[model samples]
Target: MSLTKEQLLDYYRKMRNIREFEETIHRENTTGEIPGFLHLYCGEEANAVGVCAHLSDDDYIASNHRGHGHCVAKGSDPRLMVMELYGRAEGLCGGKGGSMHIADLDRGSLGANGIVGAGAPLATGAALTQKVKGRDNVSVCFFGDGASNEGYVFEAMNLAVILKLPVIFYCENNGVGEGTGVDYAVGADSIADRAAAFGMPAKKIDGTDFFSVYDAMEEVVAHCRAGNGPYFVEAETVRFYGHFEGDPQKYRLKEEIDNAKLHRDCLKKFRSRVIEEGLATTEEFDSIDSDLVAAYKGYVAEAKQAAWPRPEALTEDVYITY
Candidate 1:
């Protein structure tokens, strides 16, 4: 489905937000202000923004360690996100979740997981809740290609299909799971083939192209929301950063990064498409860019000034009701 002018602007805004947010995190991480590890989603912006464009707060999403993009795309506040990264009292999780465990359940973001393939079960459980509640909401499970190799992901897939749950397994195959390439770790040429083996319909799209991911998601999400059980989408893309902020990236070649930036930047590809199609004007795009820069800068300033959560509260929220 082609996006309307308003939808185009929204998609562009979300993508820009993810980009600026990551860059801000990188800057803060360098200054040693951000606590714990951060897995920035610098290059793979399209997969999150595109798929999430089709969702609302009523729908749930389970995110992996590299989940800032997903959280921002799903309407979690950016200022809160920055505060969370800074371990501030104003953070979404009140500085408790830090980077990897940041979450806002009211917005339907279950949480950003620290464990590999952990999101699958949570998403499956959410789908089950929706089914039992007789709600027409779908759940999205976002994981890396590396997480796809885990037993939990496969088990979740089987359970989701068997129960005919409304879930979409979004595999952002950015070629690597940590430092190892997905080709070396997954033991499969394409993740779609694996989905097919489980009797699930899967689609593979170029993750660097927003329209490709967005358009494909429109179809797949609609199918799942219609009680067609789970659908799988494997997005082929690349990440510009290493496994972590301070990673030397010794495992990857410099040429790969250069190639992705030059030819496979998803935001660039999206901007080009909307302009070429006359769906959005260049001035509109520029205005959005300017607004995003200002907004991100403001968030960074506020987050830095915000106080960290109280030391006494560190022991809170360890159990639900016990």
Candidate 2:
């Protein structure tokens, strides 16, 4: 609410970009243009944008398989991301790391990991570096409800609390964790409760609402930057798509998916709030949406025409010499 009109519009633009980018990937994947496994970040836009909005380039974040949104919100070039997915040499990773592994260190993205629960320790280590060097920058580890059950996640939480590191253990609890319901898999009452058991401050919010996520993260980021140690946040969101592109999603009921898409869409909620508050007009939002569609089309076309990495370059950047 304290955000200016421009800030609200920027939020809408970022969320729309993520939605368009993911939807475009979904379409291109079916056509065999994008390579490898892609876990689309269709409905989880607010969580990434809201959190990263409070962060600076000095801060760090590690992400899960569904990471395009995080990369975009963190300021990675979508053109480079598209190129990466297409396996072009011009990609952020030189085409070696595909959809699941895109990283932009310059943007403070530690890269998206294919292995579940891998980002926890990575972010924790980054936070430790900040503390050691007496920097105020914090680190955030974006994991899902599925990754919450991993041992290393809990390990990272405990270490963070013990060291009082500036890190946030963010759980994007989208109800279902890759076909396994969180109810059946998560032993605790909730992911936040499980994290609270680690002696860190914890809370859960509606991830679909950008304001809710942004406000909660504002306080959390401030707390960490002030040297109050780690915090835990579980954003209960919904993914409009399946676990992966082409996933049958038989584990989810049709009505459940439909209800979430209609009632809990983050972009819709954001637009309504901004418009009702007289902060932005529908025409403004529509302009952003239209511009993104055309821009993404261009990204795809350029990526398709980009060159592949040379074979000799494969052994390059794979190691460091003394």
Candidate 3:
């Protein structure tokens, strides 16, 4: 279905939010204000926000190491996220998780996993619980193409199907898996096809297009929510940053990155579509841009001044009732 005016505005806002948030992390990390290796999701904004638009607080999502976008889209607090990146005690997970493990259970975000394909099982388990309880809630597992090759992901899929768990296996195919393209690792051209082999519903969509991803996800999510079992969606996307903060990205060609930026930019495409449909005015978008600039600047300033995590927290949140 074509997006309405409100949906269009929401899509634009989310894509822009992800872009701005990632860009902020990039700038701060480069200046040595934020600690640890950070992978910015500057270029793949739509894939996260679009797929997540159909979800709710009752629903769940599992994220990859590059998970800030998913966290924000799933309704995480921006201030806490920034504090987490800053390794402050007020940060999410009490600054114990850092960039790779930021999570808020209250918001239904199942924490970004450090090991590839690790989140699939967690999401599947969540879905299983929801299913046993007869809840309509669904779980979405956000993994990269690289994670698609993991044995755990495969096992999770089979288990979810056997239990008829309402889970969506979301594959963000950003062309490369930390330098090696999916083509080099995955034998199939379509990740969705692989999901079908496991006897589940599957489809592929242009991850760079917000409306396309949103519409497609609505269908898949609906099917899953109706107790039709698990589904798979492969989003064709691209990341502008290196595997982490400081890697040289020598495996990729400069020309390829530039080309993706020009043709496959999700934010640019969202702007064009909204403008072309006359559903939103350029002035409206410009207003959002202005607000974003101020918001990001404010977040960075506050984060830089926030207190760092205390050494005593090293043993906290590791185990319950230990």
Candidate 4:
């Protein structure tokens, strides 16, 4: 790996932060502390961290509903994020936008969208702006295996390729699109093949492996930054959680879930790799995790204590009455 020990450890902490934050919210949602529905990004940490590691704060990323990991990977404050989940006044979107729509434009996070495949166009637009303005900054569009089949996604890809925009189509193909399998929805033999048809650099990677995801993304990000056109990456990841917090998941096999947790967990794979490479120790990673637990604990607690958005502010950012 070209990454330093310090860099690998930093990635570890970022993944841990996402895992802990999602698990915490999963528990808190049951007690009603976290408002609104959620699509937890429990097992897709590597996909987000790997790609975002190559992006700057000036580079934009558009995310889907399962977006906490993306936001954390891109440097959104965990405290404000937790507050957003709680619909507090000080949240990321001033509490109006919950889990599905957390935007931090200053951080270049376009937002966690509710509409599937919508972020692709937004990222495309960001990339177009960069290209037109002669900026080297690239934009990343993180979507799911399901959204990969969306018409808007293909449209965005076509535009991006034709315009030679600096955008990366990062598809977290978790095999399951909500409840239906990817094979059912995506007519293409492989989702990445869609990009292949467009003559874009398409890679199908093992998303459970941090190094694998990171390395692939590093090359793509580098290429895009060098003024190359858009690329497509299909990361074969696993979603440890169901479609939603309360999803019965009748479609999922318990054994598959167990197998994924045991053998395909990104955190486990990452920890093993780092330790084997002599880059870090188990105790060292655990220490970082301890701090993460405390930080998330504080974030959730502070969010609980935060005030709600004022009633008068409800219509404040809605429209133009003049």
Clashing pairs in 1: none
- Cα deviation at 196, candidate 1, in Å, is 1.4
Off by over 4 Å in 1: 320-322
Q: Give Cα-based local distance difference scores for all models.
A: 0.90, 0.94, 0.88, 0.92
Give the candidate number with the greatest lDDT: 2
Tens-place lDDT per residue, model 1, 214-297, is 889999989988888999999998898988899999999999899989989888888888889888888999999899889888
lDDT tens string, model 4, 240-318? 9999999999998899999999999999999998889888899999999999999988988889999999998887987
lDDT (10s digit) by residue, model 3, range 208-258 = 888778889989999989999999899888889899989799999999889
Model 3 worst lDDT run, 10 consecutive residues: 1-10
Ranking by lDDT: 2, 4, 1, 3
Tell me how many clashing residue pairs each candidate has: 0, 0, 0, 0
Candidate 2 off by > 4 Å: none
Candidate 3 lands at a TM-score of: 0.97
Total backbone clashes of candidate 4, pairs 3 or more residues apart or in separate chains: 0
lDDT of 1: 0.90
